[model samples]
Target: MAKELLKGNEAIAEAAIRSGLEAYFGYPITPQTELLEWLSRRMPELGRTFLQAESELAAINMVYGAACTGARVMTSSSSPGISLMMEGISYIAGTEIPVVLVDVMRGGPGLGNIAPAQGDYNQIVHGGGHGDFHPIVLAPASVQESIDLTVEAFDLADKYRAIVVVLIDGSIGQMMEPAELPPMQPIQKRNQEWAVTGAKDRERRILSSIYIDPEDEEVINFRLLERWNEIEANELRYKEYFMEDAELVVIGFGTAGRVALSAVRAARSEGIPVGLLRPITVSPFPYARIKEQTELACGMLVVEMNSGQMLQDVLAAVGGKIPVEFYGRMGGVVPLPDEILAEIRRLCYEPVAPSANPRISWMNRMNITKN
Candidate 1:
């Protein structure tokens, strides 16, 4: 197989087709619009299903309908569209239906403009759909990452009998890079021993997250939290770069993660002991892994496109063992590597007052409409 230059959105669309998704139900949303456009044509040509739903509500319901039939399904939307689909996602989570939701996140709150912002971090990772559950979320920072993780998202969704989200943003979805196509093989539909598609000749499976009784709901919550704990123990994944002998560590994900990577490389050239903790799975956040690394650093710096969403998680994970600082450029404006590298230098080598705040805020931030 040969590799080709593809935008992150295009890579995801191509990977989905190659993964043999039975259908895609989505409405056009910026950043991810090109992906829907690409798949709408190719899926029909390949004798598959692609429906441009009238609205986010309709599209998510379409996903609900399709997943009920034991189909591999997906949908793409930005922040607000994803907000509208929350009800459906909660229903799907409650029923334990298998699904994959792609959130090419843009600026959030209301109709935040079509620039990349990860403000949806807490919402997506912390049960945005209203339930005591954690969806398997794969956060990819590059075009190749988008392709690889899209296919893995479906697999994980099926494996867990739950929703899996590939969380990205405008730059990753729109930026171009080279990626190789994998051979197509039909993903085995999850065995229906537990799912509630229909009972052909046996006791019917019931997929419902609702329990009327408070005790039963409590039990369900306990079971769900236990399951999440299991996931955290076994599935929390992250990538570490240049951390063996580092004085400061930089943490980020998605597009911000990529930018931080560049800063890490630059600091390395200048002989600064800088490392990176780029998380691949944000839902089962790599708290333990981060804690392990922070033990060796002077301080940890969190860089994101939001007003320090992930930074909170870092603080909780740090347990005040070391000072944790945040540097961000929110709204549509993403921080450049050179800008981040400057912050890295300040944190790496600086004299400060005992009460001085180390946070860095770039001047070119955009106004974010919070929802």
Candidate 2:
């Protein structure tokens, strides 16, 4: 009830418990190890299930099993670990099981480092696993947001009978900040007639992704897309910061979005008409909202900790209506506010050679030296 200081991972784990999580199966990994560690003690004290699986694969399957029992379940890991769970995630989606997954992203196409990075954007949002399924991805920018989204992930998962991902970067997972914990939710088990509780009073309900007939599989795929359309139409979310009378809009999500806000404020003080557009829901991204801003602004700059993952999404959103540029910091390095501000200046005020890449690299060694 009272405000207290907590690390982002700890806050998220507590939020999951308060959100009526019945079971959590996770392996310890940097940036997200605290989440598993915290629950290891807390879950037993609360008489709920907590497990340290032999590997990420084992953990996700355990979550699959628990979710099939109509229980609110969760699991967490960092980048490489998450990759290992992709197969199970696909199976979970194929069966239409509701479960929450937390990804405190770190660097890499491989084991890059323990520092924060946003490289998982494509892998998480654009179907990391096989099949034409989409997971609801919520990117939180603060410790409080990490907690808030963790709570929301559970509700959304159950509401749609689909996987929900609470995506935060390594910085948020490792940093400490003040947060107000939500009130403890009363524990309640979900009622799914199809849950695999051994046949007792009712007839046995079958649950499987195997629709052997191609026609049956086609029907199920269409149904899934129909549901996705509903989510895309209804769940698009974003927050605008000082967009009125702005000529340039800076777009980012998760930790990068938070940094972009700082750059926006700095740009405005110098009379550069700049603002920020932060996406809250990464998947079913706010395309319509971004298109509206593109009409009003001269150009847009996309900021991220990856090469150009979300940049492509922004480009698609604008559809060549205005010039779009990109600035990034990869391999666990976070772009400084000034680095972002410099790029905004280039887009709004400075002139550059037309032959240059449309996407600018603001963090080059020369620029870093100047700064």
Candidate 3:
């Protein structure tokens, strides 16, 4: 009802609770530990389940088991911790159960730091585990968005019988902002015909990811692909700013997108025709929208907190119709508005050729020597 100054991690935890989350299983991990900590106290008080598992591996499997019973279960972790849960995640995907995962990303390729970074974009959006399935990934730029997306993740997961990931960086997880949380939803109990509740007095129902026959596994793969097609068609989402009659466009997501917006505004004041396109849904990326922008914009600048992970997707969407440039800060380093503003200026005055590799150009600009 009223807005409160809330930390991102705690807000997301509370939002999940209000959305009728039935169980939470997670281990303590930096940047996201507050989420697990908040739930540890709140869940039990509400007579719901909260557990600090032995490890990230154990935590994900616990979520897997709980979700099998048609419960609204979730688990949260940082980058390295999420890596540990990949195999279990693949299992859940193969079994076709709805589960919510919150990944508050930190600097990493391997346990880098507890600072903010968007390095896990490829891992989460592209599917890290061994699978032919696509997980619905939503990226939020602010605490309010984090809270809202947390609630949406559950609904999307259940609707598609798929995994839905609410992805944000450590900065968003740790920052405080004034935001309104949704009212607590009464938990609705429904008999899930597909769940593995005791098959007492009825025909036994079995749910398993294992398919011994190649033909059967192929069938499963087709089913997953068909569902993914539906997601791509119905779920593409993004935000645009100053796009009307702009010739140069900038694209980013999450914190990087937020930072880019400021840069775009500064450039606009300087008489540059620059706009911003921020994708809220990273998976099932807004390819069509980006393609449409190619006709209106002369060029684009892709910005991120990593080494241009989303840049690849932008390239695919643009399809060589226009030149695309990239600028990024890696290893937990967040780029400033000024930095992106400079990139926007360059994109306007000295555009690169469509055939040029943006990442290498960026590396050269940053003075990073090729090995």
Candidate 4:
């Protein structure tokens, strides 16, 4: 297939259609609004379902209803919009319903800018809703990867019978790039015995998140934990660059990861030994790979588009064995490649005052976040 230029949001919508997306329920939000708009026209033409709900909450609940009927359903929104859907997401997770959610994140604690930011890391990856559940979060660094991962998100959501989140920053969502769309996948029939489509000649199916008995709730939690463990073991995914014999490793994800990789190459060209590790699956988090790769390096640098959200995860993975520094630009500002390269060089050569704790000292000098 010939590659066509497309905006990140358009690419994602096209990919979802090809992947047999049976239904989409979403509210218009900046950076992600294009995704909904594109699908609105295309989905109906293809005889699929698309609805613009009155609110993000309503949209997510619609997705919940569609998913219960064994439909491949999805929803898209930005930061505050996604926040509105948390209650519904928790219900979807608890019910073990298969669905996909696209979070084209923008800045903010509340109604932040419509610019690119990875500030939603904690909210999406750490279970924003009230429960002990984790969604399979996929962070795509480029437009092409966004399309490919959208398809994978649907497949994994169905395979695990759980919610999957395609977490992309605004930079990736609104930016245009050349992409080859995936082949059309055969539409999967939704006439499953588990579906609550109408109890005709079969046992009535009940899909409920509520567990009346405390023990039943505990049992549900246990089963979810087991499934999460299996996903962690089998679904951990990441990418490595120039790690064969490196003195420093840079860690990032989403758009920040793409920028960090460019910086790594620029530093390498200048004879500085630096590498990069990007977590493709943010929830499972590639902690084992991070530890293994950074163990031999002098230190690690975590570049992000937020105030060190993923930095905490990097710190946990390294266990303070080696110095881990952080640099980020919050509230929609993105850090430049030169800035990341400078930090990488400073961590490698600069000598600074020592602190009571090595981790503190490591972050004190390099951890800079722009407001």
**What lDDT does the true structure give each of the candidates?**
0.84, 0.90, 0.94, 0.89
Per-residue lDDT, model 3, residue 68, is: 95
How well is each residue in 116-225 modelled by candidate 4, as lDDT tens digits?
Answer: 99999999999669999999999999999999999999989988888899999898999999999999987888576667888888888899999999999999999999
Error of 4 at 365 (Å): 5.5
What is the number of residue pairs that collide in model 2?
A: 0
Best model per TM-score = 3
Ranking by lDDT: 3, 2, 4, 1
Q: For residues 1-371, could you state the per-residue lDDT of candidate 3 as single tens digits?
A: 99999999999999999999999999999999999999999999999999999999999999999999999999999999999999999999999999999999999889799999999999999965897989999999999999999999999998899999999999999999999999999887757788888989999888889999999999999999999999999988888999997899999999999999999999999999999999999998999999999999999999999999999999999999999999999999999999999899988888588899999999998884335
Which residue pairs of candidate 4 clash? none
What does candidate 1's lDDT look like per residue over 83-201, in tens digits?
99999998888777788999999986799899998988987888568867889899999888889898888877876777889999998998999888777866565566775567788
Model 4, residue 76: C-alpha shift (Å) = 0.3
C-alpha positional error of residue 53 in candidate 1 after TM-score superposition, expressed in Å? 1.4
User: Lowest-lDDT window of 10 residues in candidate 2?
Assistant: 352-361
Q: Backbone clashes in each candidate structure, one number apiece?
A: 3, 0, 0, 0
What tens-digit string does per-residue lDDT give for candidate 2 at 228-310?
89889888778889888888999999889999999999999999999899999999899888999877988888999998789
For residue 331, model 2's alpha carbon misses the true position, in angstroms, by 0.7
| Candidate 4 to native Cα RMSD, angstroms | 2.1
In candidate 2, how many Å is residue 77 off? 0.1
Clashing pairs in 1: 94-209, 109-370, 109-371
